[model samples]
Target: MTGSVTVAGLGPGDAALVTPEVTQALSRATDVLGYVPYVARITPRDGLRLHPSDNREELARATHALEIAAAGGHAVIVSSGDPGVFAMASALFEALETWPGDRHPEIAILPGITAMLAAAARAGAPLGHDFCAINLSDNLKPFALVENRLRMAARGDFAMAFYNPRSKSRPHQFARVLDILREECGGDRLILFARAVTTPDEAIAVTTLAEATPEMADMRTVVLVGNSATRRVGRWVYTPRSAESAAG
Candidate 1:
């Protein structure tokens, strides 16, 4: 009896963003495990157990979630944003490989609306062209890799969406990203700040790269750095092709 774990992105909340498929899976789930805030979104039902864990206890939380599913029941792991984007799916795989269990359960990854996409939508398609997401947190991966990716993205002329830009402990990470961008793409590059999208107190701000500040962003803000080809029209920001620009 192989039970499977289904990962669902609950979107920003219980509003229109919740997909029919996610709702169906939630209805059928024997247990739902996630970081505390994500699991708090849904109402609990009979046989629908909720396992909320500390956010930093990622690997352990995933291992426990899988164990629950392998015990002859259904399980779903909830990630607030897209699981693959920067969420639980990879950690789950990593934990499995770190301590491979004899009883392997079926696992499946489902997509959810990522903060960057939702942020882009609110800011009028800043990610219309090439873009990349880099986590500025150097605790896991070295900052050198982060800097390398930032430089590469800048040189490649790609719009950038930076995740985990800053936290309490690591406060100066985004400054380095900004400096790199300024040197590579000039200070005139437009930037969109989407902080805590879909939440009641969400904020959206647009500014130039020269004016971007570390205090303007935190772990929750999805930083958007427009490519050289990117532009702003009225309330929207987008990357337009030279051919399209000429045609217009």
Candidate 2:
């Protein structure tokens, strides 16, 4: 078999949102690898093998998938949300950078609906204008960098979506994030907390920066902060598409 490695996204917790392209890749996979929860989403079959690992083993998982593919097996690596966005695709390429093997197996990255986009949709076009996505985890980068990016994005009046906003381990950082937003964007700016988007337990709340609390968000939440011009009409929150809307 001509071996291939396909990195696929499972999308935010909804089966319906998983792309057909990713589904096709999984159906043909001889070996599959991913974080435990993501791997669990895949159905087990007679000829398929699932390699589930802890969150910290991304590089190892990617290398193993490559090895399997190079040996003429169809390997599929899964990730929640798009693999290219803070997921397994980057790790797979990082392994390829130092790959000692002469033969490079075919590699492909398949996209899926990410949590930020799902959350944005739930809140109705909050990202209609210019926006930026930021990962607030600080696992691979410094917290100062996160702070700087938050400040710059807010100061530039761009709509923003945040991933990995708050967790039990670092519960207090999100408080600082809220404070920074208040300083840069003022108290009346719109902020949204969308949790478990597209899943049965999904909850979405839109509030002002002044009323927003850190406890409202968790690891499962995707937070959205609207630009200065973002507002609510009836019940929907959205940013006006015109540049003049910001100045008006």
Candidate 3:
């Protein structure tokens, strides 16, 4: 039997949030490959093999999963959130571009609940209107590109969700990001700092751009900035579904 490769999302560190489809895929996988923390989430089974690697080794992990699948071993590559959202699915396809074979192994991409959606839900519909998700890490892309996108998103009056907002290595970048947001969206715009949503250590903070500090975010946090119309009602923060004209 020809082997197949599946890229699955584990869903934001919560087993309860993992979809039935991903659970079924894991049950049938002979070999599982992913970042060390993500691989650790899978339970050991008699016939299963788990290969865990460092966070920066995405391309290598994807290639190894493809090689295993091509050799008639059922392989699954796991990612933290939805595989297509800045995760392994794109890396796998990049590896497939250089894969040498008469016929490639069958591949599948299974989606999971992404971090932004979970964070938004926890914050009471802050993303109720149109929004854009941005990955703030400049590891693969240029900082200039990220700045340009942020400016355009704010200019279009779109709410924004940011992933990988801060890390020890890139500490000052998020500060600069906050500066840009403050310039574009002004100091009164509301921003939410959500860390480890749906987990035991989860914390959510809602504050304005002026009140939001760079220290408020870390690599584990997902940052959300509300548009012009976003506001708070009682204990909840949300953007209305309808658009209001400037004349009104």
List per-candidate RMSD values in Å: 2.8, 1.5, 1.5
> How many angstroms is residue 51 displaced in model 1 relative to the true structure, after the best TM-score fit?
1.0
Candidate 1 lDDT, tens digit per residue, 110-174? 78888888899888878888688877788789889988888888887788998888888977777
Model 1 residue runs over 4 Å out of place are 241-248
Q: TM-score rank, highest first?
A: 3, 2, 1
lDDT-better candidate, 1 vs 3 = 3
Task: Say which candidate scores most in TM-score.
Answer: 3
Query: How do all models score by TM-score?
Result: 0.93, 0.96, 0.97
- What lDDT score belongs to each candidate, Candidate 1 first? 0.83, 0.92, 0.93
Root-mean-square deviation of candidate 2: 1.5
lDDT of prediction 1: 0.83
lDDT of 1 at 77: 89
Model 2 lDDT per residue over 7-45, tens place: 999999899999989999999999999999889999999
Q: Which residue pairs overlap in candidate 2's backbone?
A: none
In model 3, the Cα lDDT at residue 141 comes to 96
Candidate topping lDDT: 3
